[model samples]
Target: MFKNLNQKNNDSIRVEKDSIGKKEIAADSYYGINTIRAQENFNISRQNIHPELVKAISMIKKAAALSNFELGLLDEIKKNAILEACDEMIDSNLAEKLELDAFQGGAGTSTNMMVNEVIANRALEIMGMQKGDYDIIHPNDDVNKGQSTNDVYPTALRIAVLKLLGPLTKSIAKLQEVLQVKEEEFSSIIKLGRTQLQDAVPITLGQEFSAYAEAVNRDRWRLYKITDRLKKINLGGTAIGTGLNTSHSYIFKIAKHLRNFTSLSLSHSENMIDITQNMDIFVEVSGLLKAASVNLNKIASDLRLLASGPTGGIGEIKLPAVQAGSSIMPGKVNPVICEMINQLSIEIICSDQAITMAARDGQLELNAFSPIIAQKLLNMLEMMKKAIDKFNNKCVKDIEVNSDKCKQILDNSLAIITSLVPYIGYEQASDLAKEAVNQDKKLIDFIKEKDIISNSKLDKILKLENMTSPGNNLSE
Candidate 1:
């Protein structure tokens, strides 16, 4: 792109030319004609590209400029100006000018050019020159030295994901911690356990909560381990990963600078060409996220069931009264927090499917579907973190177990007789269970009134710990 506006007089607009042709850009605009062309050509979603991605790209530009200067490929003056411009972008809203959708053509060429143009113009201004004065700091020759969108875009994407993973895992850990606390608090509350929605036996509520915590802990570790894959970025692999216009020296220097700039353990891919051709890493990350969402969905469903009602349903626990459940009802509260998590979990699952499909459609040397994958993956990470934090603070922390209700429900359930199988014999116990249910009586009361066993023996046999655990220590 060229900007021959050095001798121009107009204040409102300036003319810039690319191979495609010339167009008038707003003189006050930081973005150049390439960004405008992209905005016009691909008016798909109209959403801004991920801000983290823009920041990642800016860091790449800064590190690339510093490496070029260090290698004598670029002069000190231009390098300093570009570095400052990149800092401003990293620290401020300079990249808000990148107004393109997440879906675009050319494997993120438009988004890459948008970053290049913004940095080049900002560098020119930092050098006391005009915004469009490419004669001093051209976007391609200087700001984007020895880089291609094919390589830089995916590299920036990896860095962005790496940055987000820390917070996401922390959120998972927080939820797990909350569940663990709940497990400890409910350890003594024996309740009727169900299988296939039918009462089966006695189980302490703590065991159910412990299982939820273990699932979340496993997800946290899975996400934490995926970092090893995200750290292996395909940078320094110019167009098509062959290092077409770059050298080994420049590639090695750039990687060192990138590591310092982003503070991430970013390793340049050993097989850049293979990394460029395959997008399996994204599919793997999405698969793990889907697994987490499945666990979260089930946990949320369980909470909703346990907190179903105060009068008619299984009121074994109470959630925080976040909001009114109905407009017409006088007094009713809902499990809106878990419901929100349920909705977001389903959305994340859907986004994972999109990522899977995108990963599968990569062409020979590149995947134009990367923009969509990046968009979905980052979105999943961001929203899931917020959802988990909300769920932990608003719902899980304030949960109250209805122990009286639990005791009543368990005493009334005939399934509790399974504990007496050894003492009364299964056939005799089965007969007593049928007799109790037929006469609308408690199983314990029916057995005691029938003089089947001494009341003191029944008390020892039916203690909560004895019924919930393996041994009763009441030998015949």
Candidate 2:
């Protein structure tokens, strides 16, 4: 149904020419071109391979090279070449010359091929040898020795994500810091609290800000908890979970070397069967991302509402103006970063859905879609990390509360009746609240007219501190 998307017509595209096996090879549509075609051919969704997969690829190569170097599978000279090539890929210089898409069906076989080609070509350049000189340093026998895409790709993804957990924790910590500051700043400001988008009672603005802080803190802790689980990899499992052709010593040896190289707390799974079958860790990470998204989305939405207007709406708060608000309207500033963060939340939420769907697709022995699941989950993590960084550094840290606006709304609020409970009693206060709302009169005016409390008493209770702290025990 979607093959038409890959159709090539009369239009010409520039091509590079090279030699392969004594024959001229045209770089027209063969090298990594199948991936690009598949991308177009399978327009089932706009979803592509996650960017985090690149980090995963780099980690795997590093792990493999370190293992090989320690176990004498390769000499220092070859290992150095491999390391240099892998580093180049990490720096993303090879991407300009290569035209591969990040997605493929053979459980990242295409990605593996792309990696092999990049390393081989770069190694050739390093050795002063021509590109594709397999005999000098073959892509398969040398670079991919004793490894399969199945083990290597997933292991790389795990390591990459585990590495990212550190920065993500820091981002969450930064956001928590911003939230803490807001909590202190707004501690004495009371406003009507909403339960289901309807007014319920009064709550301190500080309380709401503290809630956001707790949420980010929880997510940071959860991500840290899962980091150790991701450290357990399937590198020694080989191709079909049998460890075929691999000696018993090489299994643990490779994992140990990889651990030292990455400087990460790494371990090997006890059961290859369970490792290949259960993707619970992947699902767990995805679920955590979803939870984080919920908190962030709610926070973003609330910020937008709180910072709604300076003239018309409930403009109790003000967000930093990072960009011009309108193309036509002059002197306007917009809340674009908040909007972007909200959209990122939605995308991360959708990635969780993809993870769930992919996890459920696993069968008896192996999950064919583990690669995609790993890719998507890691992508969500990175995206969330980036969003949190931007929101905290750019938006949250610079937010300002409109003091005069908040005071104006609070002074005119009938919602202040709850604070009068100790003085006027609940029933009388409730009655006065309803009367004030009906007449659209300020609570101060209502209190003064009804003589429920003396003017001096009302003034004392109406103080911000008194409203925020109901246990002051001052008599009316």
Best by TM-score: 1
Residue runs of model 2 more than 4 Å from their true location after superposition: 1-52, 65-80, 95-98, 197-200, 420-428, 448-464, 473-476
TM-score, every prediction:
0.94, 0.83
Tens digits of per-residue lDDT for model 1, 1-476: 22331223557787899999999987867778898898888887867788889999999999899989988989999999999989988887645545688888878888899889988987888888988999899999998899999899889988988888899999999999989999999999999998988998888999999999999999999999999988887778988999998889888988899999988988888899977867888888888898998999999999999889887889999998987889999798888999998998899999999998988999999998888998899899899889999999999989999999998988889876887788879998899899899999988778889987777888888776777666763645
Per-residue lDDT tens digits of candidate 2, residues 183-256?
99888777766667655556677888999999999988898888878887777677766677566677777777
In candidate 1, how many Å is residue 470 off? 2.5
> Which whole-number lDDT from 0 to 100 does residue 265 have in model 1?
80
Candidate 1 overall Cα lDDT vs. reference? 0.87
- Residue 337 shift from truth in candidate 1, angstroms: 0.5
Candidate with top lDDT is 1
Q: All candidates' lDDT scores? A: 0.87, 0.71
Q: Clashing residue pairs in candidate 2, if any?
A: none
